[model samples]
Structure formats: structure tokens, C-alpha cells
Target: MPSGGARASIDLSSATIAVTVHRQGATVPILIDGRIVMPTGVAIGPTGQLYVGLDHAAARALPADHRYVDNPTDLLGTPTHTHDAAPPDPVELLAAVLRQTTFYAAHQIGQPITELTLTIPPHWGPRRRGHLDDAAHRAGLPAPTLVTAPAALTAYATTLGLTVPPNSCVLVCQVDRHPATLTVLQLVGDHYRELATQQITTPHDLDHLIAHRVIDAATPDDDPLRTTINHPPDAPADDRHALLESVRAARHLLVEHDRAPVLLPAPRQPAVITRDDVTTATQPFLDTAAHTVKEVLDAADVDTAHLAGVIVRPAPGIPALTERLAHATGTTPGVVDHPHALADGALALTAAHQPGPRAAAARLPRVRLRITDLAGILALGACSLILLLQPVLTADITTVDSYVVGARTSVPQIGSSGAFAMLTALVIAHLAPTTWLAGTPTGSPAEPTTGSLIRRGYLAAAVSGLITATLYGLATGTALELDYRPYLTWTLGAALPLAACTALIAVTAPRIPADALPTWLALARPAIHYALLAAAGMFLMRAALSLTIPVDLTGMPGLVGSLGAALLGAATILTITDSRVLRALAVPGVAIAYALVFTYSTKSALIVAYLAALTWWAVRLTTKTLHLAFPNAGAALHRLVNRPHS
Candidate 1:
């Protein structure tokens, strides 16, 4: 879940339908007016008779060539016989079923269904997906969006308020009639990337195993029921199908009951099956399922400790598999109980993000430098030029720098010209162009004129110039030995306007939308904001103390060196820990420690705070630049930074 809420708020309407086709059948589950309406899975028979859900039993009683179960797995292979004459194209049959399912859902909801989303197995490649798309088109419907079942399961998990943070891994285990699929999906950005997937064949089907158990309990050793259970394919199709269907129903009934009766074949009594019987029958399958999950995790190079969550979509017979998966992954697994859970997931994903290549392209940051950016660059260049020329232009002048350099000497120093330029550049850098901190506002108009930007730049430069000149005069008048009173007054006067400017820039600057930001930047945005806030506070503290506390100008060098070393040591220690709150608290704690240690002469403390704030800002900017240039490395570094201490 995001800070606001779950990211799976789907905007479903009558025009859209979500269909899931798996080993058993096809389901159309639609959400309308906050209610879920699922129509029965439909099929077509050899005689062109339409079979809907349970009515499929009648179609199954027909000859082998006249009826067939519409299993999605068959799409991976050649076409099969669904009719007596020319076999229907597997793609055509699937399309027809989807079309029919759509119509059925629309009729039930009393609305037209235009858009379709189909969920398939994770291992499905482009070819299989293409087949599904072709079927949708052949059915006279628009090309359907295809989503992987594992990804869909994750979407469903979000609906349950399960939070899988970015860069974390989620293990999804789905046990159906065909084979158990174990997939490790990592949440990269807003979507999930498949890390590893494996389809493991269980030694025996849960339903078949339960059916066998029921026969053993209800019949004699030499009874026909025993023979039917032993040789299922050779038994009468209707009897075997009916018995299996009844067993499946009993297994589901056991979900809410301790025991349920399974209807046996004719001439036999119904066998009462217990929940214990279902659990026992599923033990082998559960064992294999757990092992498969472990293997997939290993393949994905994801440790159990790093897993964000575990989700299980168990077959109708084995909800107990959830516990087995939980034990395997060391995380409680969320069980998906809805029969059309995959379809629901697919719909959520579709609504949240666009599918296919278009979505992939959309995730990339699209940035283009505009006129305001160029104006900012020019302003910075001019400021740099002034700073560079100040030394040469003032070489002949002897300036007293008792405040910074101990004693007056004939040397070039950071005079009015250079300080003004530096401050101007800083202000322009924050105000003129959009940055992560100062982004372009959504739905804002075009950039301000270059002249307007330049005027703002010069206004900032003039303020910095006056402040520097006033400080210089005060330093010289007091013989560079001013007490805390005058310094504190100057600091407060300067800080007030600087803070106002910063706030104004933050409010007026255009902000980039969160979606447009790179994943690494988006994930680090909160941390970056905190860092900037801490840096700003430190800078303010430095401005106040650098002038206020009287200092022995002679020992300033040694005092400054000691403060720098202490601040560096503190930063190094703080960086090693991953606790954000601790890091945030440590910033002010270090400042207070410095203030106490250098109470008699806070000039060194002032220098240390200023350098610390500047260094912090520089590092944050460098990190943002590196992440934007090399996202993969940035993501890795983010994981490293967020990793637990252990």
C-alpha cells in the first residue's frame, strides 16, 4: 500500500469486462456499482449446444469427439477435437468462449461490455499471448490486454491492504488442476517484474486423491466403485466426471465444515469426508508446492528474510496449502478465496497501469530543457565569471579579513563581489529551473520570460551584496572582535529574508508530477526532502553562530580543523545506520553537541555547521544525478541504504 491508500483502486464500468481462463474453465467477473457479478464459465458443444458452467456436465456425457473441456493449457499446443466434423481452431474456440462469457456477463449486469482483460500463466511467452489476442479479435472484440496470473495475484493482495514496498520481492504460489506454479515477483516501480517462475507437476491431483479416499471408505474391496477409482480413464465418462465433480464440491464444502458428504457413483452410498481427509490427501501436493516455492526464490536470488510477502492461490481442495507456504517462506501467506481472483487482479492492474510496450515506454522519464533552464544556466555562468574575476580585479587592494583570516593581510578574499555572486547563483539555481525539490507545478502555464528570471537573479545578488558590505564594515569597525549581540542581530535579519525567499521559490516553482519521476527518485523523494530540511536548519544555525560568538582570531585555524574532524566522524557513523528517525535526530544532536563543546568560541562551530550543510546538499544532488543517469545502480544503492542493519 502507498501512503495514501492501496494502489489497486480500480475504476470499473459497464464498458469493461475482466475474464480469466485457466486449466478448469473461463470466468467473467465484473464489478458494477461496488458489487461483484460473476457469470458461469461457458462452453460450446459438438452439436453447437451452449453449455454454461454446471450445465457442462450434460455436454461432457456426449461422445469424446463431440465434447471437450475448454482448458487454456491446450492453447500452448495444437488444436483439439471439440466437434465431430472438422475440428474447431483452438484459438477460434477460445475466442468464442470469451465472447460468450462477455455476453453472459453483460446480460447479467444489463450493460454492454466493450473492453476485455485476460489473465494467463506467468510463464506464457509472446506466442501464447499473441494467440490469446488473436482469439479476442476473432471473436469480434477489441484486442484484449493480457496480464500474468502471478502479477494479478499481487494486485489482489494490494486490495487486501497488503503492502509490498518498491524493490521488495513477493512469492506467489498458485495450485490449480494442471500444475502448481510458483513465481517470485519483485515490485520494481508501480508494476511487478517476474523474477523467477516454475511450474511443478504434483504427483497426484487433490481432487482425484480425495475421490480415491471416498471410494475406499464407502465401497467393498471388490466393488465396481473400487475398479472405477483405480482405472478412471477406462470407466464410464459420465460416472467418473460426476464422481469427480461431487468430490470437488465436497472439498469446497469442507472449507467451512469439519466434514462433508461426497456423492459416490450409482448403487453406492455417499461417503462422508472430513477436513482431515482433505488435508491428508493434499500433503504430497503441499510438499511439492513448498519445495517449488523455495526453488523459485533461490533462482531469483531472493532471501526469505527479504521477501515482502507470500500469497497462495490454492486449488479448491487445499486451503491448508497456505500454512505450508507460510512456513516455507517464513511469512504469513494471504489466501485468495475468490473463484475469479485472477480475473479481479487482471482488472485492477489494467485500471492502474497501461499494459504492453506502451506502458514500458511511459515509465521512462521524459525531460527537455526549456527557456527558463537556459536562463538559469546563463545567470550561473555570469555569477561564476564575477567570482573568478574578483581575485584578479582586487589583487592590488589590501583588505582586512580579521573576521575570517585572524589578522589583516594583503590578500584577495571573499569580498562583496564574490559573496554576492555566490549567493545569487544559489538563489537562481533554486528558483529559475525545476529540480526534485522545486518541480514544475501540474497544469501550470509556460515558463516566465528570461528577463523576469534575470531580474530576480539580480535582486538576490543585490541583497547578498548589501549584507556582505554591512558585515565587512561592522567587522572593521569593531577591530574584528564583535560580541554575540551585533552578530546575532545580523544573523536574524539575513536569515529571515533568506528563509522567505526559499519558501517563495518552493511555492512558485513548477513541480514535476510523481509519475514523471524515475523510480529511484520517486522512492527516494521522502528521504531527499528530509535531508534538505536538515541541511537548511543547519545552515541557519551556522549563519547565526558564525558571527555571534566572540573568538580568538589567532587560534581560529586549529579550532576550525577540530570542528571539521568531529563533524566528519559524526556523519560517517550516521551513514552506517539505516534508521531514518535516528539519522534525522542525530543532525540537531550533533549541532547541540558542537555548541556545548565550543561555547566560549562558536566560530569554529559555525564553520563546521556551514560546511556540513553544504556537503549534505552537494551529496544529495550528486546522488540524484547519479540515479537519473544510471537507474540500475541507483536502485541497488537504494536497497543497500534501506537494508536492515543485520
Candidate 2:
């Protein structure tokens, strides 16, 4: 806090940048002897580090007679704005920042930059992040750890003096057009703890906020910018348009809305929001929010009688919403000015309550362990590896264990191709969640979706493989003779499990929820159950085949052939029945007749394919029925629940 405490050395004036500090005749915040200036005309490295952008606007801001050591072209965003400079490469952008900073810090200030930090938007991506880190390595600065937009907002929140009460709850509600976030914080000794963070958006808040802001911003008497809908009304609102709209809305509110308790940007109008206005604007958001608060209380095992009143931080919308929540819950709630709660709290939590960098894995969403004993990061790594190698691994149409159509015929080729396809699927599944997300959103739906079916099918296959392998090992099966029909018999065996597993799933699937468990755990449950069911199906199919057929295909290795054959049948039955037990059972009855009428030359591959088709159709049908029963007007879990609406 002293004026001359040693500073990090970096010359801020070498470039055409200026630093401005609002202290009483004091210098700007600087690292090492130079001043700190607000960076402008910049792009972010993949990792969200800020890089001086090459847009002419940046140069334009600099004095006409400024000079630097490095050429502009060496940095990313090479071509000037008028010349259509290739948008800065993310990695180069990151490298440029470090290079520039390091050059200033080292040669200019005689110090190796050891620590670095950056502020970035919340929705940063992985690829871009890698480039930023790479750039930091090339430069002398230590690679930065990400600080989210909300967390950054915290710096501002603390300055505004928002505090939570003892034993009292504080809910920080942040609203943006794309989403509404509610994070409840409970104050404790010199720190606060997280109660909950919900990912639900209400319809009232879902509209293009920019449009509304612009409408609100425009004053009847004095308007500045003419508003135009860039694309059609239904076309998605772009970033530029959204920002402009926000500016306009703030202006409008300044002039029109009664800014009493909460101040508006206008000098005369303080922000005004009544409790009733908040309740009406938010509606049932409070209902679910209140429930969540109660649940949080129960989870923490906190008694309200021992607590201080509640605290509410209103986001973009009316502040009254927080008050309404307080009223409904019978807890006296306190209020904080919005926008900076998350960031400020993050810093406080770090210093006080948080597990710190040492136990960071437990706090990170990516590393959090699920009840199913799966780690998201590991799953993601596996998926990425699979997708990257899919073309090679699953290069075959027909495999050695399974038949191929329009695929390579050789055995080695089958293995290679199978691996490639699987790898590809694994990669694709992670990157594009549509396939996985297609399933019913509800933790428990009467009927599942295509996504669920696919998820379940793959799951069944995996579990069945393990079970079959375990059984085969127990039997100590030796290298036996391999014949075409017998090989085919083994292939069919794989399908049998899939079919039988799906059938059993169809029967009891409704009783237990698919989504209720943690994501990793939930994903495994369906697969494991399906595997057991399919295994049962195969056992029965072989029993029937050996008893009836004269030259049985029973003597197959790994029980794989039978499962392969049964898979298609089981999947088909489940798919066709729309998750109806009666309808699915009837599928076997019909298939038997069809096989009798068509031909006795039944192939295992054909059966598996048949079951696959059935699974698809049945899931689609079941989902339709489920959708009718419980449509997703809001959160998937929220809709399916039998809450007994009075």
C-alpha cells in the first residue's frame, strides 16, 4: 500500500500507449517503472490472453510519430484492417503478448516475468486456450490461469460494498439474454460458501435482450443511433447488435423506469424496483428458486433459527426479484449491487474458504468424480483419442467378429477398420453431443430418445463384452477350430445380448430414472443394465437354437457369435415397441414367423442389423410418447417431475 514499494519493471511508454490513474496526483498502476494503460484494439489468444490487435484502429490510437523494436507483421493480425489482415492466429496472438511483455520486462526492466494473469470471457474454448499457453512459453511470462468474466466482475462488486448476513442466505442472480444464473452464497467466518448455481432460463428472460435494451434505451424526445434489425427478426442476434441494444436499453431505463432504490446511469434517477414488480416480472422463477434454497439449507444442515437474514444481488433485471424470494421463504434477505459478486467472491473464497490450488481438482468441473467412478477429463481424453484414430481403427464395413458390407474382406483389415470406426465414433460423440443429447432430458422419462437408445446400445455392448470375456476366461476356452458357420454363429451371439438387454430395459426402464444419477454414473447404468439383459437374451436364443436345429451353431467361442445375432433382434424389439413391454415382446413373436416364412438360412449379421433398426424405431416412437406425456417447456428434469400442481 506504500507509494514506493518495489514495482515489477516494464516500460509502458515504449509503445504508443498511455496510462491514466485516478489517484490524487499519484502515478498509474504499473508493473516495474512504467505506467499501466487500458489495452485497446486487441484480439485474444486461444487461451484468452489479450494480444495487441493489428486493426488500423489500434495504430490510429497511437501517436503518428511512435516507434517500436519489432515489426508489426511479426505479431498476429498482420495485414491492417483495410487490407483484410488474416485474423490473428490464436497461438501467435498469445505468443505476441508474451513476447512484447517479456521484451519489456526483461531487456527494458531487468527481470524475468514469473507470474501472469488474464481476464477473459466465460465461454472460452479449448483449442484457442492451448495456443495462448504455447505463446506464453515462447515469451518469458508464466502461462496464465483463466479468470472468468463473472469472477472479474467480482472486483467491481467488492468496491460497491455487497455483504451477506450471518446464518442468512445471499442469492446472486445474474441475467444475460442467453441465460439466467442464480448463485446462492452463504456467509461464514471471514468467507462465504456456495449454496447452489442453477442453469435454468425463464422465457421472460430468453428474448433478444439487445432488442429490449435498445427499445428501453431510446428516449421519445432525444434519440442518437437509429436501430435496425441486421437480419430477419427470427435470425439469431449477433454480438455487435446485442451490445448496441444493451446500451440503448440502459439509456431507456435511465429516462423511463423509476430508478429509486437502484440508480440509473442518468444523474438524476436512482434505480427503482419494488418487491411486487420483481415478483410479477420473474413469476415462477421464485418457486423453483425457493425450492433450491430449501434444498441447499437441508444439504448444509443449517438451521434457519441460528442464521442471519438473506442477501440478494439483483442482476440485469429488477432487484425486486431477490426481495420476493426473501418474502416467500420467510427469511429476511439483504441486498448487494450486482455485476461483481462472482469475481469478488471468488477472490475471497480463494483466500479464505476455498480448497486452494492444492485441492483444485475437486473444485474443477472437469475433474469432479461421479458416483459411477468415472472422470470427465479421462472420458474426454479417451473420446478424443478414439475420434482422432477412428478412420484407421474402424476402417472396415464388415469385421472378423462381425460381418461387413462394402468393407474390406481380410481378417486384419476387419480389425483395423473396426478400430478406426470405433475411434471415429468416440471422437465424434464427444465433439458433437447431439447424438448423446438426443435422449430424453428428464432424469426419468417413460420413453427414451434416439440419443438414449444409442447410448444404451453402446453401453450394453461394452458390458456384455466384459461379462462374456470374464465367462470365457473362467471356462479356460482354448484355441478351437474356426469354421464359417460357427464364426457366423459367434457373430450372431453378440446381437443376442443387445436384443435381450433392450427388452429387459424396456420393461423396468421407467421405474428407475436414466438422468437422476451423475452424468458419468448415469451413462454407465444403462449400459450395464442393457448388457445383462442382452446376455440373458443370448442364453435363451442358444437354448432354443440347440434344442430345435439339428446341426447347432452352439459351439461358438466367447459366446460372441450368439450375442451378435441377438443384438439386432433385441434392439429391434425395444425400438419397435416404443418402450411398451407388451409391444416389444410381440416383436420376437413376429420375427419368429417372418424367419419361418422368409427362409431357414438365418445369418447372425442380418439379425443384429434387424435389431439395430428396431432399437432406433422403438426409441423414436417411445420418445414421441414421452414428449407428449412430459414436454420440455423448461428444464428437462423440471418438466417430468410429478410435483402435484395444486
Candidate 3:
């Protein structure tokens, strides 16, 4: 067995154990005092007798009805027992084995094993997984992290220093007492994706073949051994069971020795079985297994040249099977000889990788609220309140320019600002990060890619801007006391410019050059930072020009003429250079030209632009402050608010 120091120091109450349940038996491997130890899965007989490790000799002695062998193929099907009573539930039988194994491991470590990782067959679906989970719960074990056998084998290969590059394929073959299972898996980023799986069955059972050969060599054709073999049911149950057990023992012995002796029933001498005999028996199974590996590779469209490694499990080494696989794949296969290596691999993978994106989303709501989310809520709430109470809050300051003659403030009717506030709030609430966009936690199988995040950010900004313009148009039209037809025209006119600007920014932001940005702006993502900066500068300049420019020069006729010229100028400048610095520099000139051509009264345009800038600054500052004050809590809250409910 491979030896090494413990990978992690787990607490007694929260210790995790990894278990693999196969046709032969279940194995649970645990770390104790820096060494890995395996405890056998124990099953309870119907007669209340305890069978530990399902010893071949002891199992043979039990009545046929009471013999327990795990049948993973039919997890929900109960094995037949005596007709006197119903057999133990398949789930219950599995539970008994898991419970015994868990207690044994806990006893060795002097602590409770509160967590579990289980290796499951690749083809099993939700029903089978749920059944296994029910068994674990019945055994008083924690809900296990179920990993496919192929994934576990791939993980074990990595621990062995077998480097399979990303996007490459690895083949794993699991051979036990039953048919060998062949699986092809591809390494995608940090996780393994199963490509194909097949089960290879031999024409004859290896144990029966070995037994028949031994009997022929040791006894004459007319011997009682030949008669017993010819009709198993006619022989005494004890003799039949003894002969089978002896054959199994000899097969195991030959795995290490070139030759071994198999004891026959009474009045018969022990027969010597050579390694060649065992090989002849296993050769058919190995050939089938090798063919299945090639077929699985073809099915997965993976070439032998792209196959980075081949891994086989249940390691006391299957030399013939290994050789066949190596010859077929043109790559020497790595043998995991340690009996409990599958369980160990499961445990190691659980420790090394974080949950996937879906799992992280499910757990997001339970996460504690952070300071950043609280800040966002407060900032948004404060904006809504101010907008709703705008008429009352600014009732005293009715004049924007006291020095300029006839410059009276134009306050909207009571419900106009309130309606805009309600609509804006509704739009923003719905635009919060969706489930797919929220992504996984750090170090998870997959994280939100940079491109996806940028797209989401731009989408939010565009949607928000469009909605804000619509709300503004409705309120402004109501305050202006315009007729329905003119109001409709005015609303459309107001919305179109904002929409055009949003599209313009979206198109330009990505094309901006990195070196063209100032050193201060280099800290943030180029697209997001530039978009935000351009938006902020636009509003700030609009407010500055509205307050400073004389009203006559910004009359309706002059405004329309200059506004069209300014747009043409800005578009030309954007086409000429892809520098964000130049783009930002052009904003002030555009705003100045717009103010000269457009009649934006000091009381209306100035206040709206100033409020927009104030809200953006407040949100930005609050987010930064909260992140610095309570770093962890702020991050958690950000994820919660942004994470999609679905």
C-alpha cells in the first residue's frame, strides 16, 4: 500500500470518510496518526449474525438464503432469502454495512466521522443516487458527496503525479469480481467530464474456470470430484460450498504466487493451480475489457494520441489486463494497487475542489447580508425617497438663478416625481444579478468569465438608462402641462437620445485601447470603468453647462441645431481614435455645444443632472467604504444581492 502523511487535520466532530461500494464489497479509508487505514464494510445476517468483510470461507458456510453479497446493479431490488420471512430491504442491508464501517473508522480515529464522500457508478441516475442517500441517512451517516468512479480514478491519477493537461482525455478501467467497467473522461478546466462508459462481461466466470481446471488435474475422469462438478445441486451443500471457497482462495493466492494449491473436498487431494491457469481464465475478461476501452474511445471521438493517461483500479496489480490496455492505447496504464485507493481519491477530491456553480447558487440566500448590499439598498432607497418627496423637499428654493431675471424653478406636480421614483425602483430591482450570471464561488469548478461579467454590466447599464429616460419623459411631460399628442412626441424624442447614447457607449467601450487610459484608470476593467466614467462625465457636464449658459443661446431652435452638430462631432471623434481619454475629453465640448443649442432651464435640467451625478457618487463611495470596513461580510452580501433567485 502507498504510504504518506495525512493530507489534512480534520476535527473529530467534523471528520470526513470516503467510501466506495462495489460488487465485491465496500471499502472505507480513513487517515489516523498520519497514515491511511482501511476498514472493511460489515453486513448483518438475517439471523443477527455479524459478517465482517464478507470473508469467502465464512460466506460459503452460511445458508444460501442468508448469504449477503452487494448487488450494485439492482440497488433497489431485494435479494431472496428463506420463504419463512421477507428478506432485509436492500437499502437496509446497505445501510447496515455503511453503519458498521463508519463506526469502525471512527473508533480507530477516536472521533465521529461526520462527513462522507462516496464513489458511485457513472451510469446511475437520480433514482439510484437518492436510494444511496436514503441508505446513508438510515446508517446515521452524513449526506455524502457522490462522485462518479471515473472521476475518482482520475483524481487518484493526479495524486500519483500523472499530469493530464486541460482539454485532454483519460481512460479508467475498474475491474473487480464482476464485469470490468470502462470509462472515458475529459479534463475540462479543473473538473473531469465523463465522455463514455461501457461494461465488459466475460463468457465464463474466472472462479468456475479455475475450479474446473484444478479438478481435472487432481482427480481422474471417474473420480467423485468430477461427479460433484457435473451436478452441483446433487452434491452435499457443505462440500459444494467448501470447493467453491477453496477455488476462490487459490485464485487470490495465484495473484502473487506463480503456483498455489487448492484443497478439494474430503477423500480428494489438494490440486496445484499455476499462474498460467489463472491467466488463461482471466484472459477472455481482459480481452473484452481492452476492446471495450477502444470502443469507448471511438464513441467519445478521442484518439489514442489525445489520450493523456489510462488508470485501472483495485491495485494488487492485474498484469495481463494492464499489458493489454497499454498495448491498445499506446500508453502504459497506471495501476492503483491499493485496495482502498478509490475511497482515498474521493476524499482527496472533496477536499481539493469547491462546489460547482449550481450548488453555490442554492446556498447563496442563506449567506449573511454584507455591508455592500446594505449600502446598495440604502443608496437606492434614499434616491427613491428624495425623488418621491422632491416637491415638498425643495418647495422653499423655487429659483435656480437668483441673479438672472425671470429664472423661476420649474417643479413637477406632486405625483410626477413620485411615479418616476416608483418606476425606476421597480426596474432596478428586477435587473439585479440573475442565477446564471451570479456564478460560482472562488476556487469552484467554474467561475464567471471576464467576458460574461462585462456583458452583464453593460446590459444592466443599458436597461437602467432606457428605463430612466422613459420615466423622466413621463414626468417632464406631466409637469410641462402638454397635450396628449405633443406629450407622446416629446417622450419619444427624450427617449431616443438616451437609447442612442447607450448603444454608442456599448459599441465604443470594448474597442478602447488599454495604453490610452490614464494610470489611475488602469486599476479597473477597461470596459466597465470607461463606461461608468463616460456616463458620469456626461451628466456632470450637462449640469455645469445648464447652470452657466444663458437661456437665450439655449432656445429651442438654437438647441436643436447645436445638438445635431454635437452628435456628429462626437461620432467623428470616436471613429478617429479608440482612446478613452480622448472620448472623455470630447464629452465637455459636446455638453457645451448641446447647452448652446438646447433650451434647458436652470430649474429643470440642472437639478436633474446634479441629482443623477449625486446618486452615482453616493453608491460608489458607500460600496468602497463598506468593503473596507467589513471585507468578508461585504463580499457575501454582494453575492447574495447579485445572485439570481432562480
Off by over 4 Å in 2: 1-140, 143-170, 176-178, 185-195, 203-248, 255-313, 328-646
Per-model C-alpha RMSD: 14.1, 25.6, 17.7
Off by over 4 Å in 3: 1-52, 60-84, 224-241, 314-318, 355-646
Top candidate when judged by TM-score against the true structure: 1
TM-score of every candidate relative to the true structure: 0.50, 0.30, 0.48
Q: Across residues 499-597, which tens digit of lDDT does each residue of candidate 3 receive?
A: 443333333333222111121122221122222232233323332333333233445544443453344334334433456898789756855654464
Error of 2 at 557 (Å): 99
Error of 3 at 222 (Å): 3.6
Off by more than 4 A, model 1: 1-55, 58-66, 72-76, 79-84, 104-114, 355-646
Residue lDDT tens for model 1, 423-497: 444444433322323454343335443223423543564455445535543443354342324433433333334
Predictions ranked by lDDT, top down? 1, 3, 2
lDDT of 1: 0.54
Report the lDDT of model 3 for residue 239: 72
